[model samples]
Target: MGRIALAELSKYLLDGHLSRRGCLGARRVVTRPVAAGWMLPRAGPVRAFHAAPGSTTTATASQGPAVPLRKQLKDKAKQAKKQGKKKSKADSQTVDGWELTVGIEIHAQLNTSRKLFSSATTSFNEEPNSHVALFDVAMPGSQPLLQQETLLPAIRAALSLNCDIQRVSRFDRKHYFWWDQPSGYQITQYYEPFAKNGHITLYARDGISPEDGESVTVGIKQVQLEQDTAKTLVQTGNTHWLDFNRVGVPLIEIITDPDIHHPRTAAVFVRKMQLLLNTVDTCVSGMETGGLRADVNVSVRKTDDPVRKLGTRTEIKNLSTIKAVEDAIIAERGRQIRELETGGVIVGETRGWTLGSKETRRLRGKEGEVDYRYMPDPDIAPLVIGDDLVKHLQNSLAVLPDAELDRLISEFGLTPKDALSLITLDNGARVQYFYRVLDSIHEQVQAEFAASTPPDLKSYSTLVGNWIIHELGRVTTYKAGPLASGELSFTADGECAQVSGSDLSQLLYHLYRKHITGKVAKELLLAAYLDELEGGVLEAIETNDLWFKEISPEEYSVLADKAMAGEEKVLQEFADYIKFPQGKLMYLVGKMMRLGPTERIDPAAAENVMRARVEGIRAP
Candidate 1:
């Protein structure tokens, strides 16, 4: 088959099955039947269909404009219609007989205070070996003591995935050798996961349908509670040192069935799962920090039969990011397709994701489940979670992104996309802070706007979300640990050192009442948080004049007009600034107000006046 034709088929398959379906926050339902008599293609160097053996696989010069897979599908569809009309031409030009099936296995790190079977802290960013406990280091005579904090969060996460949490669950040992894994065998929950049979909602440009999102309940083989390994730093001298801090951190291994059908779909599912996990404070999808990883299992076939016609599956391990995960799947798919097209076969093996080249390279070996030597831990008693306990957890379940999105839609009139964007956070605390700020703004703004119009949280939510994602993300990376030497800090026991909630609230209010845009407020917030966190401030942050100062109303308006006049093109660029005058003008007004007291401008009043002008811009 021509490469164009194969690309076209891939699209038809993706769109046909994933475009129109029905589902909303449900578990994966297995409905497709597996086909029999599938054959694995032989593996070898990939070559183009028309190329002779030993010919180079590199792209030739003078190819036309690159066509998108979707467009290729349309062209093929048109060609098919024309060919159907000419029986004589169809025999030579028509292409047929090919199928591809995909399945994905994702490993999501669980959020917890300590490791699964040890007291080693699971917190991110500490001294190299500080968090390591005796059991984590595999020290002699050390026995495992499972932490409820870890187990409970794992259970919640499984539930969040829409998986059926098994009523009875147990652990097993997974044997693997790597620098980070101090234990020869990782004790993991395998036989019974906390949950299974769940699904997540996904979105695509064409708008994924129920069937598209109705992902097959990729039978979760299990969701095991496990221990994470430590980090290894390789130096120039070929020397490696271990940072055992993360060695015993709690981890949940979620193993999925071979039910996924495409790479992008898998990416979407992983993202959805990440959002849910982060929302419930169950896990942090820390790609850079190795808190989240994926081992993708990919296979291909030439038959449309759901279960039949699969080439060998290759496992791509420890893909740290969503992009890497997606790219690996696509690359693997392309490889499989090309191999089969040239009468080559895919060999089952393990592969490593290479970000630099966006490809997967063969790993040494494949370790099947049988290699793990599943056995119950004799030291630790079986984990027994009571119904009442689960009920209590459900009752006290943290606000999830889904519920927050619903609130944004119903209460603030935010679009689903906007709501989802607002809730984006690597840590649950940040998301909670976002909602808190929104609630604060809503309480004040709603009462003021309620008599005339309904409240819209879009402005406040967007402002805060932007600040958190950008500014906070930057400041959090600073080396000095939030504040200076010491202002206030939280003890591992959960007690505050010097900072109090009232003081923090006052500092925030001072900044807010200054008429500061969220960006400016965020700068002040980071400074204040650091000061307070490091025991440097009690009343000092509140007394900072910069936090209370604002530009006067008239001065702000004059500056806004000047900015507008200086850039007429901006008027066209941000036409919405005039259309939604009140909401949009504030962003620009805030920019102008940033001149601070030198301009003696009150940004809040400047916003009102500038909004009045912009609102008039659209008037007859």
Candidate 2:
């Protein structure tokens, strides 16, 4: 009885004769004048009932349109199934029944003149092991001494991340047997680290959709000072050697909480941190040269679990690039999910990311705290970071990336995207070069407009940014090739060997004032880059005779008259366009340009003069 009434109600709804609310609330429903149905509210469930066929009230099939009830139900079911399939496909990339969590550990080498425990020079690409001191090799009777110069960069890094600096931090010995560490232990801040409880805010890069402009804060577990180990070099076959030159180099390890979920977030966090460290001049932030590296911790867990407890994690060590970090996490997360699906447990272990295969392979079983015996180092004294020192470091802190980005936008009138591109450039020297050129341009303009309306700085900044980033940046790529191939060696200090910021500034000023055309500017830049410009930009323009000459309107009128005198064909062309007022004037201007010699003439002034001459002749 309930099925029959429900069937009748579906038919009414399909025919557009029943409102949803009325159908649900009506105690009795009548499809026809004489037919009746009733809804029964039971203890367990509410049911619908239809009147018997032979009862007092009944309806014939002719009362409504001839539509089959079975077909209606089947169609509704099919539509629902299609919608469900679409939603499921959209979510298919997500780990089935699981969520991902990631944490990162970054090791940034400190920029210092000497090593942390020795006076050996901290230089790269030097003769192998030549920079190693006696103490670096753990010589007998040699003791570890802290480098005071390393403290400022560390303090600045901590403050930049908004970490709480501990006034007194102690060093500890982390004991382990390894070929790289001759001393069989490392000196690091374990029990009392320098800073804790810090965080960095990140934004998605341009391509991402949902979180493109969104902010995500990743927590900093700790930032501690430690010594770097020697690099192990594997020779042919099984023989390996160690280079002690890198040993004892100062390092700051920033450990992050398990706050990252998406692989892109992990990559973005690393990039932001790298930019911050570079801005502070703490490190070069070159992953390829081993100046910075990251260890990523990835895990997965049930998605719907309320507790959101983390599953057992696997650590992928020494991921050297941002792409490597992101790819490693994504690959590891998928691996763990697949393992769980196959009734395999995720083992707690350490792994290495193979760049060639883009997979994580087991390195060793993960070590617990007990595996590495930790104790306070009796030789080195505890570091006491007084308020005076913290205050001094804070004052010395450079403008960080985010703050500089904001300043570039607000003070210089640059768009957010352009400002970010300038500040986050890989080479710090290029960023410095941009500002230097910008300042030079502003100074020249200011001097020129001492007592007049100031030049539009917004326009100047945009112009400078475009030329520097797009033009100069493109021309400077030759240095990346072999120097023996005749490529100019562009120094990392932002100084081009053949051209300087002052020279570029002079050229830009000319371009801004319309003293030179864009084609002439490019020619001058290329000439300057190739060291062909002997006495600088002015001399180059004079020597090449590429300067643009601005003509007075009266002078341009005389020139136009001389060109139209004996040229009959040109006269006929001008007379043919006399019906259109300005056409003849435009023709005269083109003739003037074609007749001009040596230097390029100002087209605007010539156009005005030609129009005045044509109007005077037609006035009578």
Candidate 3:
């Protein structure tokens, strides 16, 4: 496939499905799936800012256009702003001002390797029905045997959320008839839940919150253990194809109090919840992978009403992404507001979010507690949470986000936003990798730089954090398929093998000391991450010739002018800075970055020189 074609494929592959024809018209693709190094072609050497058609100029060659930096890593700042605007317009919808009260129920698949009620393997990649146990298939004689492996992560998750664990909690059956669920009902904590009374502080996020960083505390109603239904992989008019691999998968349903008042804030709250659950190793938190899903309860009330009676709340079901969560609320809010104003009553119903149409369509009237017909499970005994186990899990829990944020900001001198961004990167893997690199820099700087302490140690930390967030961030997270974790290598065993903390420290140390330009440092990161730098960055730079060549300001000016001479559109955009943003100049910069055989010139420095040259030309 072509580079641009493959890049488009890269985008599709991230969504858990790839529908393209086989590579090179061979009608066969390499198994293991094509992934990693999304920006450059799979086999070619990359130039700095390898501009593709339809990509905006000033953005990274991989991802087109620059999005505003967001403190909450999951939520994109620009997207949130635009979505918030839509929400404001939709919610501005009443004769009297209204308030949106939202409560979210999230079902996250547990991290256990096996199913909750049986020893059937829980891997989603397996063949349909291959991993199913007799119990999962609801064989007449088969009985449910609770997996003990399921409880540890659940306990850890509850404790991490600061919930009070119920010593004796029993499971009840939530009766429902569905093709995917082999059993007539799901075993869940209904009459008595295992954890309750916890609260999560949605830290004042820039784009997602009301006030700048003023924290809102949302009460945790309960955290209950449950079994997930099987997946409906394909559906025809009268037939449904099911994947039983997900059958009996362990899940935790976290019910939050109706404290969220805004759509964006609700999304932020869910984002925070995903982090907490993943932090305690409760579940694989990616919604795309069937790791988690959310159902939101939305009700609108008049702001001026002294009694403040909430309208009939409609449930929006099966929201798969954080963005969808926010959007569903916004859509439903608009629907309800429009209906109420038009003299139609707000009826309680279960609605499904349609992604294509971007609207909430009614599935059925809401199923009440009586409708579920909850009954205590006869097979599974009461869930007894021993104090000893709870205490042990409390002690063993990994540092939660709030405490970590405090440490990173106070001790490390990192800005709160930067610290949160660092920790939240790629499910906190980047933070671990970042800490290792930062700590290594602390020790290695003295020997490498020949100074006890650098003049501006704080700048070094900030620089390191930025690289991890920006460049390394782009390499690891730009693509959607097969997430690149802490280490940036394809080595077998896949630990911190090819590009460890020491390697990054060494590369950043060189870049920090002005031994190499930013372009050189980035190229080295790509090389090291892709395992092209076999003997580590130091050895490669020492033994191998430096791939990047530094050019002077005047040379950069000449290249910038050469790039701009023939491109009238870009030049015109440059001439009119107000009309064109950081967009058109990207092509000019990309041309300059690719001036040499390899990506050698520093983009930051080159861009500055190019801008100066553009100014000089326009200055009449």
Candidate 4:
């Protein structure tokens, strides 16, 4: 009876879906395939999720709703910087000798210009049901035509995660009744998924983490392609509204084994997955907008039980953010333990992470595989890939985050902490910016040195990295919006800035050749990033009289003599050998630095000369 009613509704939609009386809109929606399925949007005003159909509203994309998830994150970061991570309720907490275990199933919408089975378009903020096609409406006899373009990201994800791709894969029908699902059934891979048996290791670079080292490898059970359902908007008086725009969109579901032993570790694993997927252009950053989400499976077991049997697990569905995942697991772990201690058995059920109360609310009893009535998708045929296609995908895949972390540390001579910072920020935009500047410098040096005397690029690594990371990044770019969108249109200083690698290279080139002091280099870098310098760093140096004058060894010795004469008390302290500190040496160097052209002196060389002079002093 349910199947008959769903078929009738499909036929009803197919009759005159976009006519004058259609539920979507009065006019047809025109979508250019080139402009379909939003890319990583630049930070601006974006309407995240909609409310009841009437009162229209919007929000700042970086900051979510009233509480503003990103703001909370920024505040947490500040607290962490000062106080360090305090033990939270979720930090490897055990109750009566019981341990918690969690696994995750992530469904990330693939970044594509069109739907998985039809030419219909996909988008973030399109009108309701406007992007719908015949297949999306689930009209009877509408054969599923596989969109070859949709498979690219799926293949890329599997290969990047080290999954074994199945050349021959088939689809299955997952039957369920929901107001949002127009077809009453979803087409997904189940019997033989496209990929399986992979692992993503967390903290792969820095073992400084006291958590699992390489042992924190989250085993990926399978990767399967599936179709997304429609969006249902709830209104006042229990009114329900359906939007078919998301119907039939393609998604690749990655399932992980129950290997995660800590809540924080699970959170890190999800965040790492988001970075990796976004880096490969899978477009999974839409946690707020439903472009990406996860369902976590949580269970607890007695540590002292010799058998070490697993407890009954409950599913926490639809966690959209990293914090939510960690918090939900922590809450559920406590809940399960409490229920068992009170002489109550843990029941298998589907639960929701309530945002308002910050607890997991029981939604319904868990549905078994038999309840879903899984069957072969008769309309869709087995998906097969040629050997050539698989080989090409592997060769052309984007470099994963872990691999890039290793490369930066080994090839570029960056510290592990610095390397991880670069790759994680702005979805690797800092890393990209770093390389762009490096390329400019390398090109500049190639012609200066012969092939036999190829300049040691590694020698300049520290200098280049310091200017980029410290001056340009921390001072300006990161302040623009560190935790939010990395590609902030305007910098924090309210300057519409676009500083190129060549501009930085020019500034560093002068600093490298000792034509400018480090202080002057920093000023140039700051000016360039903010676009305050009109004619670039070179012209600014020329116009502002910022060039450094080389102080001869004899000149340094004279400056040291002046430094000692002015700092009588500090010199006395140095003479007494009591309270003789490194700062006293720097204090004398600072005196000399201010005497002559401050911008022209290298304080380092002056410090060396001043140290020698101070060594010859006596208490008398």
Candidate 5:
């Protein structure tokens, strides 16, 4: 009976004369595909497709008119079948399955001080109701006002996504029920969003080359400006609490097409978006507590023509971690596949993934929102952005994260991995301190070898990348923790804002000259960074006795002699090791100096003397 109704609905939509406005409107009716078998009740002249029960097949494209309606119906079926195949293919890449279509709606909280429609404070973690204004809470007689700061970021993100920013955009009501929502409807862009028809480049992990990495493109549908709803806190005793702190906060919703195929790629897309937003300072640095959240819609279908076995789409909600997102996508794909293979159909529903269990449970129906009944919010007027305003914003909008990542690679000579890591850690502030420190390091090294300039970037880029990602990472994380011992301190907001690049450059130089091997150089750098995190008086490791204490010069020489005296089998590699280039020799020195057995002397000095002995042998 359900299949018959769906086939009739598909026939009606195809046969009906839908006006352009009706076709384009947000309220267009959506009907699921009819499964094989079960004919519809004859009403008027509409014809429907039907097959015998247990046939496992239905009508094909060759038998029908290629009208938009027919194509949509046929496409839905094809999509469903492809979805079923997606599972086996995932487990074994060679398996044939449906292609997965993923659409992302990224909700980025704006970096602003006031709410969109009210004068309430937009600060995070304030007393729940303190930031709420009567107007924000939708109290009687309060009116909505506009906030320019909120709109600009949306426009910027739209531009970044290559979207067409509409000059006049208005808000509408999205009705829903939740304790956190003081108003029954959320004011959001629907009829016409702030931006439209944009795309972003997403690099799937597979797309990256082992030799040189690059990303592929993903299409974006639009970027819209919306007001955020209040948050609900699930209390301990099966009760829920409301917090209006987030009410009226400006938000930008970026919607993308189902171009993504893999969960990791989706995560990469999110990360890239976060980087772009943060670097431009358009949105709150995402992934921070209460900064941003995302909901993902994923569907799968087979590749056969007029495909009739389109797998169901599942909405995965509130996935905060990238890893979790990938896992959920994989798990959901598996769940759907297993059901289909067992002769059970996959249902289209909204689901939530619990990271702990790695399983997704159905939460609600997707078709329920077919009647969201959105209407214009007449209280607020449309935003009219002028050409002058757009120009100013286009110019003032900070450099994008992609360009920054590329620049970090070219200027600093970083590997794709290293550049990506630093950009990820630094966010939009990638330039403010990190690059400055790197540049200072380059300059100081050049000055140290004023008579002989430092080697070109290729030699040092990896070192710099490793130093920042590993050494500095430890410092940043530790300073935010309790054991941080340096002068600088992590602010309550958990940022190391006061630290400087020149400070890092000087500290590293000091480490290099103190006869600290590359191994020890990282240690000393981290130690000084610890001081920076504490927000106290700036001090170096030498001042604090944090440098690795060294053996006397005479003691080191005796140890070197002992190492060469016996164990010819073990000692054989050392002779050739000393003969290798400086780069290879440095690696040996690093191994010797690390807290490993074999040598008690400092590796750097031992390296210098070993080279001399090797040269003596070659001279003979």
Candidate 6:
């Protein structure tokens, strides 16, 4: 007997001449069948054993049963097919007993006129390369100069997130090689970020009662100020062009702890953050335009794990929208679970989500701290914050979302849901418009109160909120340009309605006073779209022929006689209740309303006129 190669044994096993159990020298060789093929033990070379022709005995001293070649091949192929079928099933990837953990990183571009480290303009959607400055392009002699305006927004954002703002911070250069980065590095806060150890409380989705809704508090790890890189436009093939207009733009990266367990929770948190940032005028928070983006890190551990050690995490980068963030997290979690189930190790890497494919693809291996080689920049000095400056920044901060929401609820008497809805409207200008309308209404109410006629603030606030959130908000296709120009316009679905806050206030005032019907007010609103209310709601109503004429008792007598002509039952009913108008008030009002000058006439006034006419007709 000579030394036998494993390949030769595998060939013999495939050919049905050798059994799985065979003896070789001092060790016994065993081969187990696998899905793809066969599994063999790792050992040294072994002596060969030859089988007798048409016999189940080996040529050596050992004897074993032989399997037919065709049968063995068929069985192996069938097993492989079964394995493939199992892999194709989604149940094979089920991690029903695993606990999922997620963390998010949000990069929100600050709303500033100038770049973070340069005087270059930070306006978006501008002509390519036109807004780029010498410093933005990283010229040899150009040095970084920190923008003071950038700090205001960052500090406001930190306060909104309830984070601790550091009095002193320094800029560090994060070295990385990328064509989109002209400086070959990014200036960011590494050693000490501006804010840290904050938390955001997010409630469940809409329609869930506050008592029943569970609130999740996600911890904020840190909020750091950094400069944005230039935009990279990918062309045909491997060609990529860079636009430096966005280079050096200010950004605040908000990192969160691994407290998120559900996808919807992450979405709610992102939306809340966006609203808070937009409310403070920190960032536009537009995902489509790249004003805000998210990076989600997901990992899973066995639900039964006693030690509770976390599994490997995969970072999904640059999720541009809240929905994208949710989708990417769910898909990545499933991928990791499936890989683990298949006896495959989950790799720690940076992956990109292809929204079209709805799958995560590997971008690159994860980078460690040493990869960045962070160090304080020599050109820029450390930032020193005095108490006076901090107080100034704090005083300069506008009413944040939470404070405003509370005010709207407590002072204005708006419901919690209504207040939340008003503040979280997608357009920040709309939210501003809501407050302006509320203030104008308040002023009017105060004046009326001074005149000894106080109005219900709660009812008025509810009416205004409903009008803005439901009626005005429903004009989705309307032009939003006028809002940016300090006016509101609704020009879509064949309706063009544009009016300023004052014009709308006047219309609401007339309606509240019962001077005009809701129909007339709506018509006036539509008329205000094309022209400003020159003489206020009255002029608009008169111009549009929406005014209602008040009929006197003598005039209503003539009209009511005509309306009751040949209708003896209606006339008798009116005559029967002539002295007590309350009995037939509704009937008489309906008859008089038909004969009124316009539909905008007050129904109560019509009823009164009808009662006076009926009484005069039935006088003893």
Best by lDDT: 2
lDDT of each: 0.60, 0.77, 0.75, 0.75, 0.65, 0.73
- What tens-digit string does per-residue lDDT give for candidate 3 at 328-421? 8888888888888788999889999977566799999899999999999998888787889888888888899888888877777788788888
Q: What TM-score, over all chains together, does every model reach?
A: 0.58, 0.71, 0.70, 0.77, 0.69, 0.68
Candidate 1 TM-score, C-alpha based: 0.58
Name the candidate, 1 or 3, with the larger TM-score value: 3
Instruction: State residue 466's C-alpha deviation in candidate 5, in Å.
Output: 2.8
Give the 10-residue window scoring lowest on summed lDDT in candidate 5: 40-49
What is candidate 6's local distance difference test score?
0.73
Q: Which regions in candidate 4 have their CA more than 4 angstroms from the true location?
A: 1-86, 89-96, 204-209, 284-289, 354-358, 446-456, 474-497, 530-532, 562-588, 591-597, 611-620
Ranking of all predicted structures according to TM-score, beginning with the best and ending with the worst: 4, 2, 3, 5, 6, 1
- Over 322-431, each residue of candidate 6 has an lDDT whose tens digit, in order, gives 77876787788888888988999988999999775667999999986799999999999888656676677677877777677778779777787887887766445556
Candidate 4's displacement at residue 550, Å, is: 3.9
Q: Give candidate 6's TM-score.
A: 0.68
**When superposed on Cα atoms, how far off is each prediction in RMSD?**
17.7, 18.0, 16.0, 19.3, 20.4, 19.4
List residue ranges in candidate 3 displaced over 4 A: 1-96, 211-213, 235-237, 447-457, 473-498, 529-536, 539-620
Local error of candidate 3 at residue 152 (angstroms) = 0.6
Clashing pairs in model 4, backbone N/Cα/C closer than 3 A: none
> Model 5, residue 128: displacement in angstroms?
2.2
lDDT of 4 by residue, 1-620 (tens): 12335554453333211222334333333321111122212223222223343444432234322333345466768878655444443344445578888899999999998888888988777777788899888888777888989998998888888899998999999999988787898889988899999988887453312556554678999999999998898999999998888888899999999988777788778877888888777864557667789999999988887687888899999998877988898899988988888999999999999764557999999998899999998888899977788899889878888888878878888887788777666556767777777777777677667566875777676577666666665545454444323342332222224567678887777777688888777767656655577888888888888888787898887777877785688777778886567887887888898875556677778887888888878646
Worst 10 residues of 4 by lDDT: 31-40
What candidate 1 gets wrong by more than 4 Å, as runs, is: 1-100, 122-134, 176-183, 205-221, 304-309, 426-620
Cα lDDT of model 2 by residue, 1-620, tens digit: 13436755674544333433443545544332331222211112122245455334334444444334355667778989999898545542255677888899999999888899888888787778989988899999999888888998889899999999999999999999999998999999988999999998876432121432477778999999999999888899999988888999999999999988777778878877888898888885578778999999999998887697799999999998888887788789888988988999999999999775656899999987788899999999999888998988888888888777778778888777877787766455666777888899999999999999987898788778787766776566663233222433345656656568888888998888888987788878776776667899998888878677766666676788886777666455444563754655677778888877535677777787776655555433
